[model samples]
Target: MAPVRIAVVGLGKIARDQHLPAIAANPAFTLVATVSREGDGVPGVPHFQSLDQLLERGPAIDAAALCTPPQVRHELAAMALARGTHLFLEKPPGATLAEVAALQGMAQASGATLFASWHSRFAAGVAPARSWLAGRRIDRVQITWREDVRVWHPGQAWIWEPGGLGVFDPGINALSIATHILPQRFFLKSAVLEFPANRAAPIAADMHFCDTHGAPIHMDLDWRQTGPQTWDIVVETDAGRLTLSNGGAVLALPDRTERDEDREYAGLYAHFAALIRSGQCDVDVTPLQLVADAFLCGRRREVEAFED
Candidate 1:
């Protein structure tokens, strides 16, 4: 089959670092065009200021990968679906759960493939870990996701804004892996969200969770770590212990260790390509819903004002 003609919207760091490379490496996709305000697209592709212009005047496109902020994702996704273009959304599919549900409906109505890509869930170690834990009872879960915003996000002001999601932005990636590999689903039992004295979002979070089977879980997310970063999850089962670190690229136990190169975005685009070819949609909202639940029930605590 011919390569699926594709366009990437929002030419920011992620688009440049991950999406563009992934699309180029995957023969299943052809990066036909790009949408960025500067018209500063990849060397050989045409660039448009808006999706409307691309859909109206450019050559036909089979799919679009949206790397825009979650706040505006729903509108762009709806527009693409309406035009019968398959959609690939970055993690945290939409700013709100309701918007994602609506986008799911729009994709269905238009028969367009809608893939809410969770790059972390596609990490190399995640799938094998899930398979290893099959039918095992989880006794407890511990998650520690701490990173320095200055190093990773730099001057991303939106991260502290009302809809930016702050620490949960990176924390959700952990949730994606946890939800994907765990034997049972869990829900928030209590949460303490630590917001910077002046910001609208949390810079740190402490949460406790439980599953119907009485299994307990706890997570700590902090955006103020000064030096080495950490993204790790540990789950203890009836038989042994399992741990995944480095955002799910590394898996370890007391006796064995395994590591893999980060091919998350590459895997994500491949999955999107398959979905487009098969005329299917994958819209798993469990991770996003967990974020939503934290926002809904979390108790707020004001802390030292953060400036960056």
Candidate 2:
């Protein structure tokens, strides 16, 4: 295989720390260009200010990996798909489910492979957990995904804006894992979104969910925790108690420990490569649908202004 020639757009923190490094490490991809407004072009690669400019001047590329915010992802994906370029979208697909659905239709029409990259679902432990939980009755599920925004996101301004996803930004990762491991379709029962007085989006959320069988599930998300970041999910089932922590990178079961280091982005790229090679488009919007459902049905409550 002539390593898929690729370009990366939105050279932000994730593109720099995760996407770039993963592309460098994977032999299946070759970084050929970049599109960014401010980022210094990746070494030895052509950099364009926009996708239009890149398509007009950059080298022939096989695909484009978009690491931009969800607010603009739909437009970006449409642009790439219109050009018959396979698209790799970073999590949350789009700000709204409707946008992602539209992109899916566009991809089908253009005959381009569209991949909604959910890095968390590729975590080392996720497959194991999914295998064990198969055909088992889930009694309950609890998710605690709390982290300090100051420590993790630093001073990103967009995170507090509408469509920036705020707490749901990280919480979606948990939902991706849940939707993958549990076979049943879960629906949002109720939710309380706690928004900071000064921001347009919520800083925290409490969501209650249940499956078709009425098995209860709850998730508590907070962006105010100042110490020892926590991202954990525990599930109780008739087979055994399984726990996945560190954002689905580790698994603990009653029989034995199944632990492995996470190279989530690398796994994601590998999967994307496979999808492209197989001429298949993988666009699972269930996780994003859950987020949309939360937004649609959630009751908003005002909280104290959050500050670093």
lDDT tens digits, residues 155-272, model 2? 8888888898899999999999999998798999999999999998889999999998889999999999977889999999998799999999889999987878778999999999
Q: Which ten residues in a row have the lowest lDDT in candidate 2?
A: 37-46
Instruction: TM-score each candidate.
Output: 0.98, 0.98
Per-candidate Cα lDDT values, in order, are 0.91, 0.91
What are the root-mean-square deviations of the candidates from the true structure over C-alphas?
Answer: 1.0, 1.0
TM-score of 1: 0.98
